[model samples]
Target: MAVSVTLPALGESVTEGTVTRWLKAEGERVEADEPLLEVSTDKVDTEIPAPAAGVLASIKVAEDETVEVGAELAIIDDGSGAPAAESAPAQAEAPAEAPAAQPEPAAAPAQEAPAQEAPKQEAPAAPAGGAQGSGASTGSTGASGTDVLLPALGESVTEGTVTRWLKEVGEEVAEDEPLLEVSTDKVDTEIPAPTAGTLLEILVGEDETAEVGAKLAVIGQKGAAPAQAEAPAAPAPAQEAPKQEAPKQEAPKQEAPAPAPAPQAPTTPAPQAVTTPAPDPVPAAPAPAPAAAPVTPAPAAGEADAAYVTPLVRKLAQENGVNLATVKGTGVGGRIRKQDVIAAAEAAKQQQAAPAAAAAPAASGTKAPAIEASPLRGQTVKMPRMRKVIGDNMMKALHGQAQLTSVVEVDITKIMRMRNKAKDAFAQREGVKLSPMPFFVKAAVQALKAHPVVNARINEDEGTITYFDTENIGIAVDAEKGLMTPVIKGAGDLNIAGIARKTAELAGKVRTNKISPDDMSGATFTISNTGSRGALFDTVIVPPNQVGILGIGATVKRPVVVDHPELGETIAVRHMTYLALSYDHRLVDGADAARYLTTVKQILEAGEFETEIGL
Candidate 1:
């Protein structure tokens, strides 16, 4: 039997991917779960795995071809049977012309039964590719009534560019959660749910554009809701109303106009009345207005040429502090292009150098020599996709929302003690090195649960705020490409040991670039640990579409005052670390953010369990 391999959806907002390379060639035997091909999307480049142990029979799509999710890319045939000769004409026809044709009929009957069953087995493999194809198999036609439209993401946005579609038709979607990612000119943002229901249909494709009032998708209640019937048509209004009111209002206006002409006849009886209007006309007064315009036209061309110069030359002139008006244009019709402006600028630079060259020696000898100046030099580096996305998001977050940061001192002595005692045994049992991050992750989850707003994101439009019920915590991992935060889903349900195990596994996958795109998504909150670098404290920039991020610093020992319930304050030795919580002030205020950080600190200091216990 041959198993068809299809492309997997990489990210929530990624619809199509280009094949980067094929790891295994056709006719090579591959083990299940081994890497088979590399696929590249805008968000990430990932290696896909083989689905079953088989020999790669054929590769359908070539490298560099962009294919949508669920498109077949390759086929693998298991060692149990050979493919039917009749089904493949090229392989069968060539051999039939050879001397071995006589023995083929005796073997034909034995292979005929298996060929009939091949189509039956191939049907089950189709559902694993995507929800759109699978949902159709179950006969789900989607919901009815009150069309749920795609959401408007921001104020200035009249439409959104659909980056990717997260849910397919008949897939269940939660209320006030991320439905899709929409990109506007200002920022790329996630559109949240207005209500909970199953998605009925996807009205748009990935990279397809849609207007604000237009329907991009629909959501409705699950199961069989009653179909709303069309409303009855309304009767036409009577035609007699307009004719009654037009004649009465026109009679009074007509009578007033007759008396006005009689008053004009009396003015004609006085001869001086006709002479009074004659002096009002003066045609020669307007001739001087045209004479005043020549003064304005003389400088217009020079000013326009200066104002419309190339920005590159303008910047070059500003950095050297040179005026652009003195530079002449050699471009088409005397318009300034970069090369023309640059050539003129070079001449001006040399002219100014003559005076500076004459004055440098005298100034150097007359006074203590000016500090030796180093030339301003640096190389321009291209940013990775992750870094560019991160930079754009940070700028958007700072500009669009009011951001507030709060710091709290946490005593991590108990956490350190716990890790120190169990690090070896835990590593031996789990085959992974356990770190202090899992404990911090647990503490963050606890803090998020106690204060749900920290796990929420602000929907600037519709005047609504959304909070997530699931606790998927994103751990900031530094990779070769850039910084990526792969999420650990349902972190609140995992114990400390489970958190340690999963964090170690995910970190290894991230460093090696083996993490699936789905593993990096649905992150409700984030935690960035800069403590490994020995930095005492640092500010962390917030990732776009997330509400908050907790920054953890290095642990250090210091003498501090302790307050006891029965015994007053006393000086004691304790281990402390600085915790910085940067949150979107649009959703959370200073007081709530402060309280959340304080709660996290309290959970770590009041460690009320054994060293190697459950969460």
Candidate 2:
């Protein structure tokens, strides 16, 4: 029966999402719980998984298409797919399979005993065999190996870039040990080894990105022997062939230009490349390629690269020996159109111009630089994958929406006095420091619940508004690595002390890089303590999905007006701070923002939390 798949409700107030990209295409086999496609919401970009194991029969909604909750995205042919419609029982039981899309912890614990025993039993046998085969196998062993993969980083994270590898090929890795470090857009984390074994191969090198669940390295039995002449290692070398072929094509073209200006013997590095000893090991291998023919082409090759050309263009260009760059481009963006290359070949045939055959020969002898010039500056520095992702998201949010910020002066004299009075006692009781940020958080969350517009989401095309029932406030923490916002799931439910403890716990997780995907999601409102570093005020940008972000400035003692019965108004010293709220202009107007801030200001000034503070 072909089962229809629809987008599930992501989080509070999130009603629709854009299909970011498809991981599994039509005709591809997908296992139960396997990621099918990634969907982007204002708050997250998460992979939607297959409901059951089956063939992906068709994609109903293409990539980048926006669809509302419950809108069909694809059809899965699970062998039981119905002809016209699913039976009544099937329709009723559809929700039963929803658990398959997420990992079930209860089921995992039930299966752990068997899993633990299997690895323990194999541990001794693996060591016994590995001792005998380590030196002889030379990475040729293929009998028993476990593939290590990049683990899922977060709900919105789809891929991660490997920053470094701690273990090298031939090194022994213990189960549950740190294997490599990976940097995602949200966090930087060390991926641990799944089982104890010898590191057989490093498939994905440093700085390379591998999608979630993509194989990164192969770990083999400690002394596993190579299967006799099976040559499974051939796949690795074969993969390198296509990558190597590109450089072969670019070599002459790059050198041709350099030499035409002033050819240097040292500049043309290709001749020395042909005689290089690197091909010896590949030619001696039993599988992979017809090694001799590929090696011989290095010297005699003309007009490099079969890429970016049709078979006809390749044939015609090869016959007349025309340089593709020399051929005038008349296609889009002045590209060397296929017809233009063919025409150049015909022109060469008639003119007998001989072309730059001499330059091609010498340039073929040249070699590409031993190391490529850095794509960035001369340092070859790469942005941590997570930082790059954050940057991309910031750009998208800034450009995609109408955003505005309003500033308000707030008097937090009473809240500051309460904090000063209870700091030592509160820290002793809760085992965590009490900070003014928690007061602001509690105040903001309280204000959000009162003025729901600040905690609402708007879908302009749908012409609807969704106001959250709970204040799942996101507190932006400045961790050492980056800015991390781990939500205080129900901030409105927590008192000042409770909010303080929760804030401490969440911030600790971010600092330790232990914050889970679930901890980061479900934020209906956001708050930033810009005052922590003594900033008077700041206009903080609201994160996508959330309607507003409250930026609280540093509190300082200042002279202010105080009303008295007989004195009318008198100058008095009080702790004062500035508050800035950046909200989505589509749903929240300036008056709404002012009203929300006013509510927060009133709450803090009221200081009716002496009981919650245990003061």
Candidate 3:
């Protein structure tokens, strides 16, 4: 019996999803509830677990292909025919085609070998051994090798680029070993080899984009000869006298490509390739060729030295006008990192300064050196999928709602004092650093409970407004990929310490690319801490489905007029920051926005959190 794997309902609004990648390939065994494939929708990217423990028989959908909800994704065959089903499909197809298409070569080799048998007995034996290896493999278990397809990286990621290949062709790899490095929109990770074997071929090269589930490479049976030899053997059957010398001649051609193969090169069919007609001292000479031929072009393109460059590190290098190839990496495995690029850039600037100073008098009257142009000024690379998604969402949100921003200045001198006094104790008790962000979140949630209209959303299709009772506040975290807002559910119910812990946890997840779709959805409101990066308040745009967003600005000590106890008005230095509240005008009027800001301002100014912070 075969079990059908269907795409289950992911969310209420997600009616369809794209099959991003298949974790288990056809004829691969999978346990029940194990991840089978990854499905991506507009809202989230998630994996679909196997419904039953069996051998995957067929895949109805391929990578980057979309299907509606409830569509059958694949079929799993029970133990009744798993072994036969696994090997038989590959053997059946290869044998049926091999015998039919290769009949001419097979016949030609048979006829020519008999006439030259006396002079080339040993030559005939070598070819026979080579032929039998392939023949026996096909007759029994086929050595067609396992296809290494790309796995799903994360939610909403449909495709990935091959950043680097860790193992070259003909290299023996252990099962679950890191075979290559892949970079998707959401994360950069290693794609491990599914089974231990010799790397046979590379289908996708460096910098090439492949959809999830696309075959990236092939892994052949252990100690299998290079597939290149098999190709030349087809044509060698036509030769009359030189039939015995074909394998020896082909051996030299393999050596030309890879001169310095790894020491472990002997493991990859060196015994089989030792069919030298002369007293050939080096049978393993051709071993390196099979592995290095395809990978040789990769280094020539200048990416070999900087194989593990991350997007953040690359962008940093470009912005600083530093050549990545020249920078000595200090990161793990000698990978280039942001600090390495910055250090290289600083060194280059120091070197250029003296030369510029020497020529300063000659160009004394020239205007101060203009800002240097960015290295990416003339380059027009493809926009990342995450950036495109963010742009589209922002544009849709802006067009869908009537939005405006209201700004207010609040004196947070008292709140600052409270945090400074309690931070040490807070960290000791909570096991997490307490930041000013939780205070802002706490105040915003309190205001939302009082002025629900500011937190309410207008449903255009239904022509209704929903004022949520529980405040699920989304904290905007600046991640390497883009701006991600992971929501803290029931924000109104959590105390200041709880809010601090949840915020820290979510922000960590976002930065590390571990945040799931569920952690990002169902926010009744949003808060953007532009102040963290020193912004003086911003008119932050509201995300889709949310009516409002609050922006926090940098706090500074400034002189201000204050009421003195008996002496009347006086000037004092106080901590002051600005807050900008952008809301949908259709649901929240200017008065409502003002009321919400006032409530938040009063909460911060009062500094009434002694009990919550255990101060």
- The best candidate by TM-score is 3
lDDT string for model 2 (298-360, tens) is: 322332442133334445667668876577755432434446776887786656534444335
| Full candidate order by TM-score, most accurate first | 3, 2, 1
TM-score of each: 0.44, 0.44, 0.57
| lDDT (Cα, tens digit) per residue for candidate 3, span 1-615 | 899999887764567878877877886666566578877665556788777777899999998788999999999987675655444533543434423322333232223212211212222222222232221110111125786877766544555667678987667899999998876545568999999988766656565555555556768885554453453453233222223222222221112222233222222221221223321334333332231122322222345455546555667888888888788876444566556787899898878877876766874676465377887888999775456567877999999999999999999998889999999999999988888889989999999999999888888889998888889998998888788788899999999999999999999887766777778778889999999888888999998888999999998899999998987999999999999999988888899999999999999988899999998
- Where model 3 places Cα greater than 4 Å from the true spot, the runs are 1-43, 46-375, 460-462
Q: Write the per-residue lDDT of candidate 1 for residues 268-378, one digit (tens) a residue.
A: 111101212211222232122221112222222234445333334456667656666665655323444445555766777678677766876664666543354456446
After TM-score superposition, what is the CA distance of residue 470 in candidate 1 from its true location, in Å? 1.3
Q: Give lDDT: candidate 1, residue 7.
A: 95
The candidate that wins on lDDT is 3
Listed per model in order, the count of residue pairs whose N, CA or C atoms clash below 3 Å is 0, 17, 2
Q: How close is candidate 3 to the true structure, as a TM-score?
A: 0.57
Cα misplacement distance, residue 529 of candidate 3 (Å): 1.1
Model 2 lDDT-worst window of ten: 245-254
Candidate 2 residue 566 Cα shift, in angstroms, is 5.3
